[model samples]
Target: MCSCQQHSGTANSTSAPKDAISFRVEDMTCGHCAGTIKKAIEGQLPGSAVTADPASKLVSVVGAADFSAIKSIVTGAGYTPSPDRVS
Candidate 1:
């Protein structure tokens, strides 16, 4: 299966939350990487709002989807999640 197909299997069916959750992404090195991460997360969690700052390597996600599952998506996209930033 392709990477996209593999990722589709991990997609979440839950609804997004009202408040946003912030996380520090250590592997987002450029604009393209940031965009890719944003798309990956939003695709996995429908209704989610994702904002990523490549300079600070911070990704804030607002949704009701499972955080652990989201983290897995980040890892699969080649980014490291900062444990301290997770709530």
Candidate 2:
């Protein structure tokens, strides 16, 4: 299912400017998967903050990378980017 859920938060040092976009990954299945996705995103966008909840199959990414690029990173890390959860 493809869906976009918007979240609001402050900009910390780990995140980009206030206008930076965030994406919710709904396909992450485990800690290792989360780690891989996090690494991939961070590798592409340094200091990117990724938080994953395996129980909810949800992953939140805060960085400067565009949605498409972030989706690619997740896919490259071997996880499917849920169309319903990417912002």
Candidate 3:
């Protein structure tokens, strides 16, 4: 599957909270990877918003999402997510 197929675009949810935390996923190589990560996080967090960019290797999560849980989700998705910056 084309990786970009899963592109969630930017955070379009005006009502959702902004990024509470961000992750540096070194292995997130393409849109597909980002999509996978995004899907996993949203699936677990429900209302949370995720912005995963392969180019920047960053995954920002907005809403009520636990840091450890996000890490676990990224890792479970077959990627190494390091704590980047928290907002």
Who wins the lDDT comparison? 3
> Candidates' TM-scores?
0.72, 0.63, 0.73
Q: Residues 15-42, candidate 2, lDDT per residue (tens digit)? A: 3334555455556555555566667788
Candidates' C-alpha lDDT: 0.68, 0.59, 0.70
lDDT of 3 at 21: 78
Candidate 1 lDDT score at position 36:
81
Per-residue alpha-carbon lDDT of candidate 3 for residues 1-87, written as tens digits (9 for 90 to 100): 233435554432223245367767777777777778889889988998787777667777878557888888778878888865533
Best by TM-score: 3
- Arranged by lDDT, best first: 3, 1, 2
lDDT value for model 3: 0.70
| Model 3 lowest lDDT segment of ten | 10-19
TM-score ranking of the models: 3, 1, 2
| Candidate 1: stretches off by over 4 Å | 1-18
* lDDT score, candidate 2: 0.59
RMSD of each: 9.1, 8.5, 4.5
Residue 7 lDDT in model 3? 58
